[model samples]
Target: MNEILNNLLSLHSESEIAEFKEARNSFDFNKLGKYFSALSNEANLKKLKCAWLVFGVKDNRTVVGSQFRTNLQDLQSLKKEIADKTTSRLTFVDIHEIEHPDGRVLLFEIPAAPQGLPIAWDGHYYGRDGESLGPLNLEEIERIRRQNRASDWSAVTLPSASITDLEPAAIEQARENFFQKNPKLVQEAKQWDIATFLNKAKLTINGQITRAAILLLGKAESSHFLNPASATITWILKDRDGLERDYQHFGCPLLLGVDEVFHKIRPLKYRYMKEGTLFPEEVEQYDPYIIREALNNAIAHQDYELGGKITLVEFEDGRLCFSNVGQFIPGSVESVIQTDAPESRYRNRFLIDAMVNLNMIDTIGSGIRKMFLIQKKRFFPLPEYDLKDNRVQVTVIGRVVDMAYARKLAEYPNLTLEDILLLDRVQKRKPLTDDQAKYLKSLGLIEGRKPNFHISAQIANHSGERMQYIHNRALDDQYYKELILAYLEKFGTAKRVDINGLVLDKLPNVLDETQKYNKVKNLLQALKQKGLIESEGKSWRMSKKI
Candidate 1:
């Protein structure tokens, strides 16, 4: 039954589509309704005979059986529940249950809403932008409604496909990378021939190459699998006037085309100052580690399921912009930047893990944090992010900020990690939270509101003689007795309260108010013992310096 059911989930004969959910506990009624409306509309638009929603797959896209919420009859009401809430009675065409060996699979076979019919949820028109369910905008709704005139890329498999259709070199590279990634499977994987390897990699079907194979490892000529537009990366170099100085299209066999994109990028030398000096300490403009991490992250995590190409743009103003065709699952850039936590949802789980195991990216979520930390340490502004046009664009600034300001930031050792990140935001003239502002003020460090703050004037050298007179002198017993004796020698007396003006600022941090008073009292007693000063109680006279 398990082998028979496994055949039910294949692309060649898929009775159902697959999706992973750790538990049905996460099912939000409202969102699920929207997904049904959108996915159904997409299925209709793409002319897929049916679309499916399955559950219980893990991050590696493996079917990890899940125990669904088992008020079994309760799920039957879902189709009617969605139709009643949606506009124009839009809903699942049908919902079926299949009992597999491990667990049950719920199949929602959704018919296309209709040609030119826009599907809506709760009276709002809906559609999919990749895996997301969003209320349909006028343009997207029209695009889907008009374009449902064609077939989807996923449903197509090249019929004449064979191992000869794929690039031998690219396939070899894939095997080397895969074997290197799964060391436990080293001997098993090594013994397998090319046909066996291709099948195992999901690039082929039943030992025969398919469209996915041609796309992943095909030679330049076979890139027809990427139809309409070619599988390419376009690099555009612009001048100060926003005119394109140069443009090039990188082609197939992407195992190597990716590196060509890298070679086209140039990161220069950056100069930053550590002190109040004229010269700059030199560092690479773009940290190689960070740029590589960002680029590979874009490539690995992008929605290849969507047709848009990953983009890397080099600007004249010393910036590298990387844009991937997908929605950032983490929501906001500030949320990710300000907190030191890892991501909750990944855009492409399988591809990201593959890249991770291959050492293209590290798994611990340290790379992004390191990028911010390194830039902050160098007093460079933190990286910026923009999500627009259904794409995630990250801009990494390569220039340095003012040297004098950077110098001051380097001095403070008591600063917390969060404070450093916040200060970088502050220096960028960005808004911060109330707790963040309060934290800085409590340190007696910052003075102004919001975007403006500086080292207090009291700490600055321009405080002149007042600070010096305060900083240089001391109120110790020996110094006081000397003062008293000098007074007695020259003028014969010293006033009690007059001694208060003698010294104070030279006191150390270790001394408290009570200890300070005791020290002063002890000084007076020692002066009396040496006959250096005569305390007529309130008034004391100095004798001489001993």
Candidate 2:
């Protein structure tokens, strides 16, 4: 520790991966977190094992002493506090308190941000411009993220773990699935031994059990084989209010754990009236294939080295959210959906290969696109992917929000998947980019202004949702101008609040409260510009010209 501290002190100034802070008193917790993110990212960028955040050191290499977290217990507790806000809950590797001759120096050892995953503080990525801390640029973030493209953690063989650590039942299931995936191999596969089958299946490297093998086939007690890494999937049932109702944790073998988690979810019967049917059509709230595909994807892509369990949250309102700790390698969900080709890169090539051979996942990269297609076919909202916070969370909505919109999806068999996705965004009240809005408008598929767009009137009328269309559709600017003019004519004067009451509710429901408020303000401004109405303090009245 002394030698390490001496080396850092010998530096002329702080570098990208080494930062010196002089905290003669206490340091701000938020600022400390920012430093943690910056140093961790710099370490990854510089290909260093770890970075240094040394306290009690001035910028000039002077040890002034630090009173930050003086108490031993409080100092240790800083780990959890930093983890709570950092990406993947990453914290200090070790905090060494060295009593230097000059003062009490503290050395914070920060591990490099994991491959393909950049550390973020409080939802933002931070980095150091030499010694100065700043937001990590996109290129740097992508550079750190691309580091995992060539590496496969699951491909690494476990030296101490063997086939004995695997569960017989899981192995049997693996054989069955493998044979099912390759019917021609069924006869020959039966003759092969467990090791031979595992080797052939790519679950083992030269008959040595790999991390992928342990995760899919290892016995529950054999989880320790992947030290500092976890192979557990947690399923939680939540009510409408987001409170947990029940929860269960499943450890490897993850093949069966996927099933256990699936069964735990209650996919209720969802009944909805078809366009012209008297009796409602009933379907399962969630599709079995969708559930398995999502769960398997989570397991396959999870950054196990982060030591976090895959999470499956089932909401009573007919939604399933599957989350795993890792960056989405494909970058954007749209790229995967739009492109028909398979992904050129994968984070866990061996695990994905094993899963593919075991009939768990497909390598075609169409799994996510298939999820979206399945939801569209079932008249459900497209699967939503939240790829923020260095994690991938996919939410599958099992029920339809709009019957008309859903029927329209089935009605227009030629409607492209991209079109349906854009319409799905509209139905979900999600904001659209100008290009998306313009494309939808050019096709006459959507109506209304920006951010307040709704389904086109033709579709609404055809689907018998004219009332909903009218509610979402905005009135003409002239119509709103007339309402304001009539109000001021009858009342002589109207306050901004009074004007809001007159036209706010009349505005389209598609516009949110803020948009609605902005609409009213714009109307007042337009009328005032045309010399139709004038503002008097906070009130409005008919203009002298009018």
Candidate 3:
């Protein structure tokens, strides 16, 4: 702390990497997060290791003391508050308090943004311009992101590693996958020795083991050759309450370990109606290809440099989460789905190519898109990607999330996968951009306003979900008025509360309480205007003319 204080004192002026404020009583939590993003980005741009946010210091470097976040608990809560809103849940690296004869000073150390990824607060990139905190300029955001175009880490050769470090069993599996992907090489593959086979399979460079070979085919103990890089995958099974039921960890020679991990997962039977058929078809809860693709992608993209092992977790409730460390190369899954070819840059080019040559993953950049399509074919929820914490987490749901939505999908085989994916988002109540919403609206495939959308009546009715269709559809105003009139006639009179009690629950559950109330109010106004009923003080009654 003394050394850091001296370093700041040496600067003697607020710059891009340092900000000073006299926060004697308190400071805005959101503003603190903005500073976190701004300072972190500024540090990255300035090529500094850390940025500082000092409280209790004047612009002129005078220490007046700070009562800001004086309570230790409140001060700690700031970490969670800031992390929850920032990209990758980034928060202060450390918070230090030093008591001086003049006053107590708080120093917040913020780590620089990761290479190629800028820090963002609540979706907006932030940076410091001189000493002012604000949105990161377009040029700066691009500058940081461009760093991703650097050389791939996995492609680098391991100087001392050799074929001896690779397990024979893993090499055999790799050979089989290689031949399976390239059947023309079957006869030739059988004749090649281990060294020749590895070179032919792209797993080795001139008989010397590359990082890719060590990662995928190295013996478990030989993982140390990658020093500080983790070559392990952890699979855990959890109950509904999130209690772990079982867990198994697999080490290097992931070529064989991936299969072991797959074997541990118990994908039970899930029965759903076959498209256009009344009879149900029983299929495995998870598609085999989908599982392999997800796992292989994790292995191929794992940021070994980050020293975090891949994790795959299965829940009793029928969902699988595959997680690996590193920024998602494309940044968003949508980008991957929309792109015409493989990503131009990868964290592990050699490893990914090896996986591709082994038929472990598709090299055409269609793996994620294919996973979504397979889930869609099964009438299951689309795979979800949660990109944060310098990691990518993918969740594949086994069961149908919305039966009505799934049934609609089955009934409309003509709908494109993209359309089905967009509709799935609607059914799940996830937000859609204006362009997506507009496209669906134009096709009459979805209705209601932006953000709160439902399957269009045309689709619902065609799909044989007339009930859901009717529920979402608003009936003629006259019909609700008739219900109000009938209630009035039955009891001779009724209060507004009584009328609401009779009709609110009967209204579509999709409408919120406020919308339900508004519907009931509209009905009453319609009835009164038509002279069928009149307000009798707080009560409503049939008109005497009736």
lDDT of 3: 0.84
Encode model 1's per-residue lDDT on 1-546: one tens digit a residue.
Answer: 344335445534222132334343446777777767776666765667556565554434355565565566777677678878764455665666566565665555665654445667777776666555566678757865454234323224677766776788887788887777777888999899988876666556576555445655678888876564346667777776677778777766665666677778775787654444423578878878777777777765555544567677788777778887655766776676666576765654544544554446666666777887777666667777788644788888787664433544555534565677666665565666788788867866444544444443333332222343343224445665566566556765557556655533345323445655665677778867766566665777754444
Give per-residue CA lDDT, model 2, range 1-546, as digits (tens): 999999999998899998898988889899999999999999999989899999999998999988888999999999999999998889998999999999999999999998878999999999999888999999999998777876889999988888899999999999999999999989999999999999999999998899999999999999888877889899899999999999999999999898888889885899886557522488899999999999999998888768788999999988899999887888999999899678988888899999999999998878888888888788788999999877999999888877777877866767899999899899889999999999998988898877678899878776677888888888888998899999889999999989899999999888889989999999999999989888888889999985
User: Which candidate should be chosen as best, given TM-score against the real structure?
Assistant: 2
Ranking by TM-score: 2, 3, 1
Q: Which candidate should be chosen as best, given lDDT against the real structure?
A: 2
Q: After superposition, how far is residue 61 of candidate 2 from its true place, in Å?
A: 10
TM-score of 3: 0.74
In candidate 2 the C-alpha lDDT for residue 427 amounts to 89
Error of 1 at 318 (Å): 1.2
